[model samples]
Target chain A: MNMKKEKQSGCGRSEDLVTYLYGEATPVESSDFERHLKACAECRDELTAFQSVRGTLRQWEMETVPPRIDIAIKPTFWQTVKELFAMTPVWGKLAFGGVGALALLALFNVSVTVGGGGVTFSAGWRPQPVQVVTPGTVPPVVNPVTPVTVRTTDEAAVRAIVAQLVRESEKRQAEQLDAKLVSLTSKLDNRQRAEFVKAVSQLKQDQRLHLASLIQENSRRGGPDLLDLIGQVQSASVEVEE
Target chain B: MQTLETTDMQLVEQTLGGEPDAFGVLVRRWERPIYSLAYRMIGSDEDARDVCQETFISAFRNLKSFRGESKFSSWLYRIAINCCHSRQRKQPQPDVSIDEQIEEYGLEPMDSRESVDDRLYRDQRAQLVRRALAALPHDMRQVIVMKEYEGLKFHEIAEVLGIPVSTVKTRLYTGLTYMRKRLEHVSDSL
Candidate 1:
């Protein structure tokens, strides 16, 4: 028991001396530790030995930097979609093929309507019969004359008239689309324009909201108050009128 | 635009706010001490680098859960120590040859005659020290490495290992006593 007590006391002294050597002791503790070390050769020698070991360990420095790591970034919607599509199996592509066929059929119906063709559509796979207008619904004839029955000549003339009508309708539709695109493009800044293109291509609702929020945030940060925005809009209106 | 004095907490907040590059500054600052701790604990440069990288990756992934209760460096050191322990548990014991151990101790046939005997004595002492260190249990070896090589305080080590301070001190004392006996044997051999 006495030997155990002596060993405990010696261990405590050694720990104190180690702390003191590392400059972690208080002033009073340092004084007591120094007094103990001055009398105890064993503690003093142990401290020196540990210090040498520490010095040698310090020599083993890592000569190279750790390897580089890739950081995770928030991927854009299109980027995620591309990744998903790339990993999609052949069966998935076939399922998408069915959806594409339905979409194409819908697009053809809309195009036929816009072109004012005599074609009628149904939900069936085959084309339905076209509708003909009643003779009473036609405009009244101003003059009574014998209708010319030039078979080949009349077919060529009808084809020419149909082609001209289709071209005019297409020109009108193109002009309207161009105007809408121009207006939308003019309202957006460069960054917003890029975001808008990305949102449309990716078909993501969140991206659209994000683009809108970014525009509002930029306008707020531009130091433009409500009065300034109104003034700018009013000036733009006046310039358009001029 | 804020010119406030940057603290680790602030850097951590910035990193949590999606500024990943901000954490790179922390990595650059603490990589050396963390690498040193790992290297001393595992005694392999390659594994130490792996530990450092793994530590940073884990710290980054879990930064939001830090809770600001402890110093960032202390948290990082704890992660590194845990990584080292897990690695030690997974790796099979290395087959260390006696000749390689002697060579690591700088013991070999000497060419010069004047200081040959003294060189042999020093080599034997080094070999004894290495053997004693290897003989220690993993826990005891870890405590010794942190205390001696990494210079962590007893309380800090306890915090890192989640053990009591007394346990840390006991392990250190036990490890050193073992080394002292081995050194005495080396002296007898000389």
Candidate 2:
């Protein structure tokens, strides 16, 4: 019975042997297990077999680790930017293109000065209306080279022209604003409200500066005062706020 | 040479600090153990290679999630073992193709410079050991591989497998017993 019991315990609890083999058993456990291993032929033989298996495993080397797979280093910042542009939505691309075209138009208008010649790209975005005399409207250019009898287009005509041009420009601007609104509202989480507020304030400041400069330029060019245009802009902003 | 001695955690910090090459250091250091574990678990060279690459890639991507809760190698082992499990599931069964079997046990002509007959004898012994191991259950195979080949401590194996150390010991003991029975002739010869 004593021999049977020892056999059962030895076979059932080889964890001590495993711990000792792996050098994990504590001092007492190690010494005790070492003594036991000296006497226990079965345990000693099993340890040897496990060791032999470990040796065999050492032989199974990865002949050559399929060439060090250097992770194609993550794209640089500019590459990430290029990827962002490439991934931008179609509406986003259109909005960017519209902004770019508007910037170019602003640069062109800033560069060219209206003189007493032909209409010189004065496609009516200027606050001061160019005195364009349509060939039919000019009453026959009697002097042939007398500057075609330049006359400021009537205020109603200019206002109508300006209103139409402003409407188209506003339409394009509204499309971009609508795109931005969709994007912003879709992402309207708690964190974005502060960003939205900052963005709006910055936009209003930019508009204030742009309109102030336009008012000054219009005054210098002997055009409409446009002081109420500022009020109109402020009131329109108030309407948006409401 | 300096990097060879750098600790895994120090390399990990370097990798996270934007020196991506540091990860390459970690890979070179750990690839052998990881590949050995994968090959022993799956019994296929190509699949093991796939698992090895995937393990490092995953570790790199999810490096931030590594909260230092365990040893870096244990964490890597966890990823690799998970990859093995996934690869096993995708296959109809873990079928060790003949080519992989030959490649897996094929002996190398290193410094020992054993004769052709000696190399063939060692190859046969290795093939027997691998077959015996492959016959064991997945849990038993993993515990044995980590403990025997990777030299992971019982607790480390437990941590890698997310089991109790007691369970690790039980599996290792049970697995060794199973391998002993299957490899009786080889064990007797040894």
Best by lDDT: 2
Question: Clashes in model 1: which pairs?
Answer: none
In model 2, chain B matches the true chain B with a TM-score of 0.82
How closely does chain A match the true chain A in each prediction, as TM-score? 0.27, 0.28
State in Å the error of residue B63, model 1. 1.6
lDDT of 1 by residue, B1-190 (tens): 9796678899999877656668888887778888878876776779988898889888988898898887788799989988988998898555454344545654332333534686454544444454555555667777777877677887888887888876776666555554443343343333
For candidate 2, write residues A1-242 as lDDT tens digits.
11111112255547787787678889998888888888888888888886765565555544435445455568568766766888999999999999989898886554333433323344344545335534456545355455433324343454556667889999999999999998887776534555544534654775777667766877888875354555565676777789
- Candidate 2 segments exceeding 4 Å error: A1-12, A37-67, A76-242, B1-7, B94-116
Candidate 1 lDDT tens digits, A107-215: 6543222223344323434434333323458843433374323222233345556779889999999999999998877876565656545534553455445445555
Q: Compared with the real two-chain complex, what DockQ does model 1 have?
A: 0.07
- Candidate 2 pairs with clashing backbones: none
TM for chain B in all models?
Answer: 0.75, 0.82
Q: What is the C-alpha RMSD of each candidate to the true structure, in Å?
A: 33.4, 30.0
Each candidate's DockQ: 0.07, 0.13
